[model samples]
Target chain A: MTIDLFQKTGAFAENKDVARDIRVRDIIPALERHEEVILDFAGVGAATQSFVHALISDLFRQYGNGVLDRVAFRSCSEAVKQIIRIVVDYMQEGMGIDTEDAPEA
Target chain B: MKIHLPNSAFLGNLDSFLRGFDSTHPDHLEITANDQWIAVHPVVLSMIAALGLTVKPGNVRCGPLQARSGHYVVRMGLLKILNIPSSITMVEHEPAGRFIPLTQIRTSSELTSFITEMIPLLHVESEQAKTIGYIVSELVRNVIEHADAEHGAFLCAQYYKKSHSIRIGIADTGVGIKATINKSHEAATDLEAIRLALWPGVTGMTRRDGGTAQNAGAGLFFIKSIASVNRDFFVIYSGSGFYKLLKPSPTRRLRLNADPFGDRHSKRDDLPFWHGTAAGVDITLDQTKEFAVLLEAIGTTYRTALRERKNARYRPPRFL
Candidate 1:
């Protein structure tokens, strides 16, 4: 599988599908390479909570435990981080992951 | 147009209100959840259902609706149905310290236009007006689901010119903050209850047979977090009277680290929960434009909730 990650800077992604595509097309292939996957969203602008949820939820589900732990997010704004935090919590609770075992923002 | 939840003890009152077969149409019928009272106008309910995906000829189908007095939760399951927004608006008003209420049903269609229209009333750019739209959307969405008002819903947007702060109050007469907390745990005083309701996961409704944990709790928690730490203050009234829970004092406002979500310290004090179902929220914003963003986010969230509820009802759980 080929790996290609595109970083876009804007206030918000138009919808969740665009967000999910970015992950499925770009991030997943990169994960196929090594046992670990680290995604760096360092310079992207404001992203919605739902968009982030669509992108990462499947990964979290597939990985079972520590799925997101292998994928890292760096240098996101407080707003972006908050969205990630909410989505992660939703996924964690939905998947029945132990809150203690879940990674923090 | 007004509906009252006469008997807080019975669910039949609410069922009647939802059906729109109100023998007492045009008059207010009070609806109560966990003792919280919300007076929903028949027209408003009709409009909301008509505008959303739950447009069944004579019945109402909402996503997940859990009501206790202070904390009420309704997930909008129709989001996926509504087309993406072509426009948005945000508003900051301090016209008076009193309540100023606006409805999402009216503004959902012309969000961009509404933002532009508010420009003259607010004398701000369309962008800032859009932010007000977001804030209002989130606040109102919270109100519709959580704020229990039997009659008139109170809303206010106060602009403190001196400090460059805008505080918006969305209140209802149903149940106060304290009563919401009592549903989860017993509390001696209103203050303790108000504070406990502010905590995460303190919902009056527990999990139902087909509902998800998303239905467990967390609406007010997000609303308060967005308003209190990020914006300004989030105040509530319940079994007791009105009270304000602000993070940094006015004197030390800027010196305080901007934490949209309150610090753990605020939870240190054991606040009591009030009995009854109604509750309200006050949110502040530094920039008006963020309001529109918030509003769209809220719309999408509720729409999803509505869909989820409809799905659950149709696909009942089947045990082996």
Candidate 2:
């Protein structure tokens, strides 16, 4: 199956609030149509940790593990990406599983 | 004009006490030795409620009083829960110095300059003076970037010659730190966000254009480091929890103390976060040099940002 990828840059690209909402809107639809989706956050600066948590953890819960089988993010700033990784670890820990054991997407 | 309000239940009595004041007779208004502004949480609520009872119910102007131990305790406690900077903090020696309240970003520069000008008043050195500039600017600039509006934030500072420290505060009417975190992160609870944000390398910056993190997860890191090394003071109040880096208990306040620069040294984080969020900082630096005066220059940078017009727009840009 063909998975659609979406890229955003400029204004909203840098908005933590909007980027979060966009992540939800963009990802959920692709879940229904395709088996995987990759979000590119290149050229984006800083994002509030909350925004990353929403995209990485909250969205996963909304869809369920099996529902969002293949998910990936590309080209986020190191700071932005680090927060995402940390938040994901936090969520995984909350679920009582090693993050490495969890499926990506 | 002394009144005792042990609880909010006494708001009516407090109201009567306030009503007793007449500007024409200022001497009669002086607080007596027994007069204590008991800022109990519930009592403060009641005070606000009582004040709300007024017919016109407009602007309420209160104190620019000398920084007292009590004021430090209550304010720090409150700001901690709210998760914003407390515009006022402990000064080492100066007493009864003038306080200027500047709310708009346009005047941030003047505010910084004003502090820089006050450096000689306290007798700090050039290097320490630069630190004063950096800390104050970082604190104030963050206010402008995040908590200024959604929270109706306001900024004010106090310079005390006797104590040899300057105290400043920035408050807002937006969501508290807890709310901001909750809104920003679906996984993080308000409380968790509070804890995490304080951790070094944890930042609120986003990947949007306006998303630049004013603080690089490093601002607080550096500030805390400086406070520790120099024996300065630092406190952060976000959402409903208070996190402090000071005196014995580094993570949280086991008990509250009010010596802005007490021997034990205490920093309070009672920034009001009733709005979506509000954040403020209260820092006290040794004022033996010109650093504080130079610190004022940072405000000018913030003021310049205000003039850019880009900041006026409420909504973040939509990248279609």
Candidate 3:
């Protein structure tokens, strides 16, 4: 399943509450259905760390290392990609996993 | 007691003035603006108005007077917003073109709308405006997520065309830095809490505390890094600790140091305890720094930090 962030929210998505709502209302259900969730960021212009964190961090804690294979990001700009990388690596380090060896989603 | 508005009511002067007010005093204080060169930012005015809202009616008096230019118009707008009576004679003049009026951010949607409206006021290119929006969004989000402010966050921006700079300020009356971070790290002092808050992956929220899962505590670290790389000035005041990133020299390359809170680079001021946090940023709008470059630089630095922390024999958990 593809989730168009810009369509769901807007070009700029930076609110934790919105991110949490997306997680509860959209992402989690897709994951439960054994479906691959692609976070499409084609039209999104920018995103803050807070927003990115709110969307993905809890998912990692719930699914553990298995989430690495279930989720992927598409059409991310350089800035958005960098933010995602920071969030992923930071979460992985917190979980005592080596980011160097972790699979890219 | 009469309080005079400064010619340049930026963060420093405004903070000092606001801190000077004695809440314990029973008498209402009078605010006077008689200078011929009275100039103030909406952020300052908004803060004063917010402070006034906390006090009883008529406890704060704003007596206005003569000004050389449109200063009185700005003052009048401030009074109108605050609902304070202005005794100064009414003046008919156009408002300043460079100022973005005070805005309140109570939710993420308001933040997004506020940033969209502020881009034009910044007088920058589309891409640069987006970058500024992202930075401002992060600063304001800190208040929303952690401030616990009863009245929400306040934001205002000013463009200085000649100086090629834009100044933005966000203030909140909520739990200060020390109180927030000390929830997880009980031993942290006020300055230490500020330093920890700036460090990569040092988040105050945890799963047990009902914090969002995606919060990796990277907001302030990324902000400070971007400010350093772009040669902008970033100042954060929470509780009694004040942190600032002094502008680097033109020839100096961007480097993330071991002590991100070093006295030489980021001065930590120990002021009287403030009830909440106020952050201000001054960025050169004309600078050709790209957001992509800043993201890459900050990403590299953060990854390096993460690798080191991961390799440590006994690394503490990141969220705590």
Winning candidate number (lDDT): 3
**In model 1 chain B, where is the ten-residue run with the lowest total lDDT?**
B69-78
Of models 1 and 2, which has the larger TM-score?
Answer: 1
Q: Which whole-number lDDT from 0 to 100 does residue B132 have in model 2?
A: 51
B120, model 1: CA deviation in Å? 9.9
lDDT against the true structure, per candidate, is: 0.40, 0.39, 0.70
List the per-model TM-score of the A chain: 0.75, 0.67, 0.91
DockQ of the candidate models in sequence: 0.14, 0.02, 0.58
Report per-prediction Cα RMSD to one decimal.
15.2, 16.8, 4.3
Top DockQ model: 3
- Ordered from best to worst DockQ, the candidate numbers read 3, 1, 2
Stretches of candidate 1 exceeding 4 Å from the true structure = A1-81, A90-105, B1-135, B147-154, B158-160, B175-192, B207-213, B226-231, B247-320
Q: For residues B142-232, could you state the per-residue lDDT of candidate 2 as single tens digits?
A: 5545553432334444444565555444444344455444434442544455554443334465412122212323234434444544444
DockQ of 3: 0.58
Error at B241, model 2, angstroms: 1.8
Models ranked on TM-score: 3, 1, 2
